[model samples]
Target: MQINGKTAISYHYFQRIKESLTFAATVAALLLTQLRVALIMSLVRYFKLINIFQVLFKLFTIEFGIDSSGSALDLANENIVLNELNQGKVSFVKGDATTFMKGAISENELWDLVILDPPKLAPRKKVLQSASGMYRSLNALAMQVVKPGGLLMTCSCSGAMTQSGMFLKTIQGAASMAGRKVTVLRQAGAACDHPIDPAYPEGQYLSNYLLRVA
Candidate 1:
């Protein structure tokens, strides 16, 4: 075959075009196969076939128990508090500590025990100052509701707020605002199930303190 120069160039161009088309088709086919596999896996999981093992593992491996808060019960539990008060143990109030101290309850109406488990005041370091203000305000109000010899259980779950720093500042701020003296009774942390990994101190989120407001 006698091929001219222009004809040879045309043949080379056609070959390159064919190779490009073949590569594109291969990539498209691979993607479609992956999508089909993903769809099948999703359907299996949705139908509970793949989740059956997880369900069985949880059912057989997990054990549950009811924690008994003996004679010295948590006054926050409505049923327990009502039951105790009915049995002539102690009285209780169902209200927010912050609002309750701010004249929500009469001055004569005082509580023997108070629990301040407010929500997370600061989720990040940037909001720590604002969160501290909220904590101080709340504690100030709480101080008014507690009797002279009453017990106060104040707590915070803000990881950004250190335990010693936030707790001491809260007591100081509340005392300064309400013009009351607070005595520290005890300090505590989370229960067993919520263990704090030494490597990850952020895992320890809860800080609880028992104080006497006078």
Candidate 2:
């Protein structure tokens, strides 16, 4: 993998990928992070790179050599920041997840791999309802563009939604509504570094699921 500079992916995220994906495949990320970008680079060295919708143009510009071909969806108007940085390599779509997904689906643009690792949707119990709605909407739109029988992996940072609880159930609901079937492949929780104390059950806050979509 050709890294632009000296950015290293977290060991925790790097080792979670168990599938062997073909290089030069079309990849999309809903919520982009350094770790996810690193993983993408590692898998497909350099062939048709597409970024997620977020506030990370400069990072990807350096990593993927983003140009007109590689695009990122920035819902929170992060493109402004990228503009200020003078990073024009990436095409930043200015809209929310729903908007970007709509365009992708209408255009029949499908991806081979999809990665999702958004920020905390439900930070407090009181907002779980709203957060759940957002998650469902995001996943539903993302599902529509995933190539048939492809892979879709998402992460939930809220401890309230664990593998056996609300999170996977939420993704399942989205898949069902989108007319997509999901086969549970592997589910991951906290890394070794993040310990869950018996007294503090909420210490394990990261829930990642790798699903085979049909």
Candidate 3:
């Protein structure tokens, strides 16, 4: 029913997913789900959150671009365990996230949910401009792939980025450009383990939103 984080100072992320995704008339319709859980840095997996999807749906898929794989420490077997865990239930594919999204649109591929967790793009303030452009285009493509009334979980882990407004605007712009209206159901931030200290502004590096594409 809830996703409790690993640490003693855990956070509950169940509401984030529960609010964003809307189930269709049949519970079986939830089979085609997609969860990009947590950060997109090397396509990390928060099993605590991922299990929520497992318990609720089936025949789902996950997207992690070929470029976004592996940590410096486990270059050879970084994804082995995650892949093994999701082997039969979810399809884990490698490709360009934006490109795959656009391709899915053209191919008329749709899903019950689309989770978008991009990497920490604007790490430095100087590159925020380029990161903004990337955010717009990426969301636009994502909008095209989501089925009507489906969900979108977009996240930003760029510490330099604004804590509010900019992200919603970028996604809203994408919806406009895609000729679809996506509603903002709710907004949230880092898990408890990744807390934001009042004293250190730069310590905040995450912003997430639960959206519904209509």
Candidate 4:
């Protein structure tokens, strides 16, 4: 309908308001949906049900010392073997691994056994290259600090890289850079607590290797 100037202006104003309200509502709905999905995923992860078998395997099989600033008793309860180690021979350094390794320990000081258990280097596909570089640097540092005839236990939880490929490359690269030769002793993974479904190899993420510095 043809309207007078004032009437047409009022009608256009209302149309603009309606369009703005629709856009705001659409954005709110998208935000709410994203929040809900994040909440659900967090809950699943918290309960460990999304990967229950894998969790169980990791808890059961891995034999490593727990490192915490607090008393080992506090963290050891999570693993029976670690608990025993805490009470017995395993050493717990209450410091960051990289810093601890770099600190005042004499160049002559030698660690017969060094365990490099860093967290997941990369969780996303896009960051794999950067993560690998980080991993290589970590290994290089560890190798420099490890004594001849000492054992280096290094690992990666980045599923983007294959276990065999990443582990071998990391050790070899580190050894080459450090001007040392390494002999692989053993390879390990998550324990019975974190069982991996044969069909779902992605669930099998932890990779460990024991190598002797030569």
Candidate 5:
């Protein structure tokens, strides 16, 4: 999906992540924070959790959605109401995600769960190198703010990056940079609705990883 011409990970991908989210809830059972460029994907994930994880959400979940675009935050707020979720439990922040992560780090604030779903950083093969560095930096910052033994669900929607098959290596670099040890608990691609042709690897444009940070 595209929001204002910006790529948004399809809601289908969120369906693939439901198990990961539930696992995080079982472990931390505290806070859930999502940093992303698109509002719909974030809202869709939040909506998906409502029915199956209703008890956990009502009693234990406090969500924070961080995005740089104010308009995106506004749309997320609207979706919250439309979905009939308790608005008071979900907070939307309008700020650069990296900056917000940095601030959270400095303030010694931490979350039990963090989702880093950035925009498509590498649109073409030529920029894949630079985009890898961006991913490393962003994930490094995000890892620092996750509570010890917490969960971090990081995603990449860049076809170039995903097809290159260097995502795990890039995340390993991020973990080293952040001075954090991470264990991959789950790995997934876009949902079954988005079929992938093995002959055309670019068809697999989404890569999601659920990591345990310690």
Candidate 6:
């Protein structure tokens, strides 16, 4: 599927998340009447994403899909109408992820879950250092906005960042910066369908981690 004019190569992660979301939704259903989720730099179809979460949870969900691009938000809205999903469940916010997180923190806003899927910050190894800083800063802000003991799903699509074997360390750094304690619940790469060749490590460009923040 094409998302925002690009082929959805990482769609597999969405499927993997669906499985986890089912379990999360089940837990939420037992404890709450609704689920609040925030997707930073989602850059995809909001309705499809919202539908997936709602269908799994079988409860009202409020999703804030934050992206900087107005066009992406437009496409997300278009997708909602195209898919016939409930429009009221999703809110598209146009803003930078870091800025949004800062605002949320100032307002003491929090969510049950937060998904940080920013665009590749470092396309080449040479820029990895600067990219790591950017990643850490953004993630620290994200951590502060997640409710204590809430779930956080973060991803780095930069091959350089993933291959450096520093993503987990980066998250630890972020936790420290945010004054939050985070425990890794799961760590994974691209889904099974997105095979990675041993000789071509770049094929393993995606690193995903699920954590519990306190």
Candidate number of the best lDDT: 6
Worst 10 residues of 1 by lDDT: 35-44
Give lDDT tens digits, candidate 3, residues 25-92. Answer: 22432323443321122233443344444443332354332334434214313343553454443344
Give me the displacement of residue 76 in model 4, in angstroms: 3.4
Error of 4 at 180 (Å): 1.5
Candidate 6 segments whose C-alpha is farther than 4 A from its true place: 1-31, 43-57
Stretches > 4 Å off in candidate 1: 1-97
lDDT of 1 by residue, 101-153 (tens): 56534654444345555667788878988888888887777666665645556
lDDT, candidate 2, residue 47?
Answer: 24
Instruction: Name the top TM-score candidate.
Output: 6
lDDT of 5 by residue, 116-144 (tens): 77888999999999999999999999888
TM-score of each candidate structure, all chains considered together: 0.54, 0.58, 0.70, 0.57, 0.75, 0.80
Let me know the TM-score candidate 3 reaches against the reference structure. Answer: 0.70
Greater-lDDT candidate between 1 and 6: 6
> Which wins on TM-score, candidate 3 or candidate 6?
6
Candidate 5: where is the Cα deviation over 4 Å?
1-56
Each candidate's number of clashing pairs is 0, 1, 0, 10, 0, 0
lDDT of each: 0.48, 0.51, 0.56, 0.48, 0.66, 0.72
- Model 4, range 1-214, lDDT digits (tens) per residue? 0111122223323432555423222242222111100010011112222132132222222222334334442343334353232222223334455554455244543443355656666787688778888778777767665556445666676776553356678668878877878887666676566789989878878776766666
Error of 2 at 173 (Å): 0.7
lDDT of 2 by residue, 58-123 (tens): 333322221122233232125445435444443333234455558768998665445555557787
> Model 6 clash tally?
0
Expressed as tens digits, the lDDT of each residue in 31-90 for candidate 6 is 343556677786453344444543423443657688888888898788778776678777
